[model samples]
Target: MKTANEKKNKMTTSEKTSKYLMPNFGVRDFVVSGGKGSWLFDDKGEKYLDFGAGIAVTCLGHAHPRWAKAVAKQAAEIAHCSNLYMTRQQADLAEKLVEKLGPGKMFFCNSGTEANEALIKAARLYGKKVTGAEGKKFRIVSAIDGFHGRTLGALAATAQEKIQKGFAPILQGFSYAKYNDLKSFEEQMGDDVAAILIEPVQGESGVTPADPKFLKGLKALCKKHGALLLFDEVQCGIGRGGAFLTSQKMGVKPDGVSLAKGLGGGFPIGAVWLAKPVQDIFTPGTHGTTFGGNPLACAAALETLNVIEKEKLCENASKMGERLGRGLEKIAKKYPGKIRLTRGVGLMRAVLFTEQYPNAAVCKKLRENKLILIPAGCNALRFLPPLNVKASEVDKALNIFEKTIERL
Candidate 1:
């Protein structure tokens, strides 16, 4: 008794989703339509507890009222504009970022990868200018298992070969070193090294936190070698690791910080903060973007920052992250050989299955149960809930998680 439109709407979304999308990325069979607070709703009206939060993009929770209002107002005013002209939204956002981040300049872009790419370019330019390496000595030292981006420059900097296999003949100037190993880093810190880019916590590598001593040692090494120390905070910054900037928590300042993911509260935007010394790496005509700081995205980013500060979401994140980690530890203790480790900070955490490597099947089953979690690193699961998620919500998620773990 259904009409054509009604029938079309009633049809299973996975049928169409699998048929239409590119085959490169794997997707679960969830057709999400709307979101609010810390929950997402599917097209079929099924409710989902969102712990992923779009890979840490919705930091203030999905569709925060103030953020939504800001986006709506900006959309009504103007959505797209080029960097050729002066934009108040972009200017104001940059000023706020520099003020909070301290003594640094900013360049707006569209995603984490773009932000990283810009950082890479800036480092190479610095190498060429200061190190007297015109073209030959432009190599950069990066941590193994680091995830920069998919673009040529960023991917070249990324240390994972599985992601870089077919994208062979990647852009040059990237050397890999052991993460949290000062001796390994020291061995690689040579004259040709342009910069040493690293993530404070390796999110894609199962939320592994870098050692503080190692980071400080690397900072000193970079200074000794005249190489810029760049922090790829795309996944760990904007309060992802419980702090505005992860380096601040470690008490070691990097020359540059690349950020995105959580910056725009689900809106598309990336920002790179450079210290005062390297501020002029990209002159006016050297680099630009068409829609990087479009009014809509800036509005969303501004609200996200304000909400995180005013709502004390960072503090909430720290408290809840500890709670989640403790609960996960109990789970790990119950299942001795099956669970290997738990690493994370704030709201970012991961648990690895010891039995198998990169157990996508476990995640597949979790998705089937509608619990919604993804595997990290070689054999782990990541939990990246919104920063403002309530303790009660964590309890609910833990219940579902316990059930799922028991089945596993």
Candidate 2:
């Protein structure tokens, strides 16, 4: 039934993917051709409401005008230059971040994993400096079920066994503690402890926000042991949780913070902000990246921040998040047995389901129904819409969610 021209122009999803891409990820049935606002369009022209926002990377939404303009302008000017030279865009972005995140110095990288790796290196250097060159104070404590990244150093900091299955002999000096339990964390702390790293909100484990009291206690414990406190805000930072940094809302300051995801507004970028005391640990030769603070990436990030501020997207996230939570609660009430609970802050929300319905199945069904949502551990579905999401889109997603539950 197809014309010769149409057949020539078309290629099956399998044909397009099987040849070029790695087999690590399971590719979806449809190929995404384009996206706008909170919607994505597939090659077959099916429209999907994107609640995942590329796993919380596109905080300003798809194809945002200002972000596109900034990237285009910068690309035309200068897309990339090695770190050997300084670029105005990169410096400007750094200044903006430092101004927003308190007095600190920042190091740029390509992703969250790299940022956490930098944090790890910085912590170890600080430890060596404080406790002498041959000191044993290099162990870093992280939380159970917390996700950092897949790289060796960051993976070592991550506490999931499944992710570390075959990649054993992970870098030494990493310990695990129970999240949200101060006593469990204390058990891991010692004179040799260099840093305590945690996520403000555990996005991968299921939208688990850190308890304010637990964060405060950890800070105190770190100080007592002469260790640094590091927050991996990759998933919760850059206005994702109604604040530039979740620690700001929690009223606890970390000695260092790793950020990525929404910081670049879909461009690949990462950063680590270090407080004054330990900021200078990384001397000239200690750490570096080839294309970290390139002009195009910084321009995209700067514009993302500008839009977030000018449009007051943080305030919007809080308001819309409340609306979203209320809607989910109402749905939970309607399907008491199917839905167990809902949790999260700002737009980073989740719906926990009963054992009868598995989270993976729920996510698959949602995708089939032209809705996109991410599955977290613990039988939960995460909703990480853009910070500038509209109330109407939230309602539409809720309607689809309710119908999906009914069918299930």
Candidate 3:
């Protein structure tokens, strides 16, 4: 008898996806049917270990009982109302986020790009307030090879040529600095520079972490130049980096921080937290979102936070990250020249490869072997397992990785 997945697979590829979805993404072969903690099942009932965690969004993992219940319950009661009115769930979520991060007022949005756009607007407003002129002191400095988002403002802030291609005349007032190089950043700073935006861990640029000293120095520089420091924690926050905020773990504070990805577990939500100095910058009519801070999203986020705290997932992430790192180091040692380096914090990790090794091919093979990983920039493979992943799952993934490397 043909299984349900078999029947579904019988449909042509074009019929399955080409009709409705845009052709931007390269659609994979199999159709995902369902997922559980640390695992995903395709339409054919074949299971694969989930190390990518839906590109680091599903921090608590798939089909989490608590998150599911909270989202469903909230949806049943009330899903959304325009931001004109306040909801208890939104207030609760904002309070929780403030408690995790330092004193700040939050503006809720629907995605990371929106969060970052808000940060940009806040910085621009701060600049206008300081200089008593619009467009003066509004230039924002961002690091090269950093990925912010696809929106026009965020895209302009992003320094990659490939991302900026075809999006000409990108919103002005943006400049680029080299990551991890304080001097490169210093050269860009001036009286007109309003903000320095960067990711604590450069998730898209091969999981490169910002040095503690560099972050501290950057904070000092921002203070000296009277500019705001914006940390894009869209991918590294929400306990994925073993801290509520990666900057918290690094002992550095920024004037504004953007968060999304894992913040809502599986649901869509985004937020920007502004420190006391800039919290009041966005007064009425300054900025707003229609579905942001809606009851359903907040309920999901609140429950996600609750689960992270109750399960001690942050501690688990630290422990598992250490174990995963040690295992990767061992593998790197075994394959000396082929494996260039391994870098990251908590579970947000990457293994870079030598030019001779094809990262894309190896990643494809790993997927064939039922182990999923994210292909990061700079010829690196990223491993973003769930915070609550077990040691045995790590071992299993390592075993598959070793076999693949051996074959190479």
lDDT of 2 at 392: 97
Error of 3 at 387 (Å): 0.8
Native-referenced Cα lDDT, model 2: 0.93
Q: Which stretches of candidate 3 lie over 4 Å from their true place?
A: 1-14
Provide TM-scores for the models.
0.94, 0.96, 0.96
lDDT of 1 by residue, 238-288 (tens): 887777887787888999999999999999999999999998988766677
Instruction: Report the poorest 10 consecutive residues by lDDT, candidate 3.
Output: 11-20
RMSD of every prediction: 2.4, 2.5, 2.9
TM-score of candidate 3 to 2 decimals: 0.96
Q: Return the TM-score for candidate 1, rounded to 2 decimals.
A: 0.94
lDDT per residue for candidate 2 within 1-408, as digits (tens), equals: 999868755967677687567878876566889999999888789899999999999999999999999999999999988999999998999999999988889999999999999999999998999988745789999999999999999999999997788997999999999999999999999989999999999999999999999999999999999999999999999988888888888999999999999999999999999998888889999999998978998999999999999999999998998999999999999998999999999999999999999998999899999899999988999999999999999999999999999999
Tens-place lDDT digits, model 3, residues 203-240: 98799999989999899889999999999999999998
Can you give the lDDT of residue 367 in candidate 2? 90
